[model samples]
Target: MNEAAGDGSSFSSKVIGIVFIILLLDLLGFTLILPLLPSILDHYAQAGDVTYQSLQSVVDWFRKAVGIPMEKKYNSVLFGGLIGSLFSLLQFLSSPVTGALSDRHGRRPLLILTTVGLAASYAVWAVSRSFIMFLLFRVIGGICKGNVSLCTAIVADLPCPKARNRGMAMIGVAFSLGFTVGPLMGAYFAVSSKTTGNVFYETPALLALTFSVIDIFVIWMMLPETLPKVIKGSSSHGGDSMDLLSPVSLFHFTAVTRTKEPPSKERMQKLQVLGLVYFCYLFLFSGLEFTLSFLTHQRFKFTSMQQGKMFFFVGVIMALIQGGYARRIKPGQHIRAVYMAIMMLIPAFILIGLSWNIAMLYIGLALYSFAAAIVVPCLSTLVADHGSANQKGTVMGILRSLGALARAFGPVVSSSVYWIAGAQTCFLITSASFVIPLFLLSKAQRSKEE
Candidate 1:
């Protein structure tokens, strides 16, 4: 394929390194804002004296705009997630279009655009004085940030099949590392800000915004244009015909069209099975976000710092499993391991629901994180293996869209469950949700053997 161009070792290394850095920066900006949100809302709600009146007015305005109940200050977290889900929805909507754009307009502009959008989002969040303003900024950020799609595209462009899994695993590693480090940074900011008693200064949103600016600068200076230009007057014949700028016409170009084996009935069945598995995986994954945040607040009465630290530990476990062990396993075995890991999540969720203190929560989080790390890389590898090279971008785009859809509903479901049955019941229901997928995966395995 394409004469296997470039020094394989160096090329592999560079791809992984660049992607890892990109994911790290992207996730770091994300995680830094999460833990501090509930605290920020509570802080503003409980302010004293003259400042309290202003803060109260801001909170009241937010509640009215978002339709959140006035009794619950922590509803801020739910609203924040709702806002984030809107962003996820935007990502879901744009993924296919963006993937197609990358195919047409090339990857460089999209990448640059995503970075700039993220930076702008952070800037909006940092300076936001009201909840409505915050939500508006988050939506803008969501519309702009397409890091997941872009990173996947980068992997598609640079790596071969055999090395692709490893390349993706490195992306997972970057996510885990960012997960680990970002919250710690956020926690530090929150604690220092708490100690100083400066309302505006301690905001995690501002910290996230600063990192985004740095990321923008890094990308602008260091990242190269990965899309090559079509040679003038060079076609499959003697004529020059490719139009790079026309999004619609670019599909007709030879670069976008390549022959591949059609999907057999059997392959279609397998894909259906995998798609089901992914749907369930994302549902459970989204539920965990709610469970963790709710449980942290309920069981240990954790401060923002404590919550951030717990996530940092979860990130560590994920980094270890994804980075250290993913490549050691074969593809089939990796999938099987991931299935077992999903099963393991039952106990982890149960433990989290039952956790009486921070220590127990940490233990549960670690187990959950390790299981998650295994599942993500394995599922991604499976999708890549099942897809043809020509349709890889499209298939991945669909998968990401499904994930975004799941994320959109996940928080809403989790919040509803928490409200109805309480934290323990919410975890129990989520635990039960894992079982359906495990059974489906088993059935798929049996069908495959046949």
Candidate 2:
């Protein structure tokens, strides 16, 4: 029995490591394409002088071979952005359903299925020859990928109440690390492709596909089933034996018999307040995403690579703050709130709105990113603290989906604002939106103590 316990510990560690590695690789692959997007579109649009007549001739020949219409080249970039947005939209749609499903069917199967789907999506992107094919692959990829939900469920399966906060913080760290490395690698690959005069679009796609394949293999070979089986003998004691399809009924049943802890109306109120806080948080976040890209492009005339580097900086600051400070800060301590408040007042976006140069832009961005990192992890931990173990995935999924919904409208909203008023006005509006969440968070904190 001791030997078996030891073996199980080893297996669990291995599975966790593999999951982390796969996430890193998947993120890296996505980042690689991002920096090159603008350039690739510009290339087909004939935006640059022919630095190499030979390369230009080859590009022309390839365009003709692919039967890309002359007028469609510039429009392809917009279509690509739409495809990517659609992918996120699909994720928003599927995540809660996937999380709820994992609650019933188990995390391991969903993880495997989603990983396989992600790989196939990458393959589709890698070999895509036309805008239609690209869009099709993006949609399919979005439908299949549920990494965030699956990972949240896995964390729920493993962590105890005391350790749950740390677990969530670690997940945030993993995200930051992935964001940091993925874009840097993508930029490097994009630069290399430019030198070789081959189309850069496919390189990142192929690299991402390869990583996904690796992820699939790692999961199949290294990961063990984490889901506990319901024993027939335990049914009399109120084990998980009910049909999972009826989630509402299952939740009600579980609430009734799964544990001895009585439901607290206060706890429910705290959760409601936390959920509102998260909703406001996501609203501001979506606005930032929409505003950042356009602001950088219009104000600094920054290239995609530059934009990616800015993202890399954000990732670095986020990882450091969340990994280093979030867990260490005492719960219910006023220090957390004070720190958050100070960070929020950094005037990053305000600076960005007024920046005349890249240096100032970077400084502003860094301040904003640092504040975001600190606040987001704290919010995540707060949610986890307020939720039951069985409901963690659902809560996280709901939070993420709300953020996605915000993001879905963000681009259009920002674009419209920029068109009508300008980038400065857009940023100013977004900056003010942050205040709404700050107020809500304060309310949440007060409610929690009460």
RMSD of each: 6.4, 8.1
Q: Which candidate wins on lDDT?
A: 1
Query: Candidate 1 lDDT, tens digit per residue, 197-283?
Result: 665433667777776777777666655544334321121221212222222222222222322443555665666566668767877
What TM-score would every model get versus the actual structure?
0.82, 0.78
TM-score of 1: 0.82
For model 1, how big is the CA root-mean-square deviation? 6.4
Q: TM-score of predicted model 2?
A: 0.78
Residue 395 in candidate 1 has what lDDT? 49
Model 1: residue 412 alpha-carbon error in angstroms: 0.6
lDDT at position 326, candidate 1 = 68
Give the worst 10-residue stretch by lDDT in candidate 1: 231-240
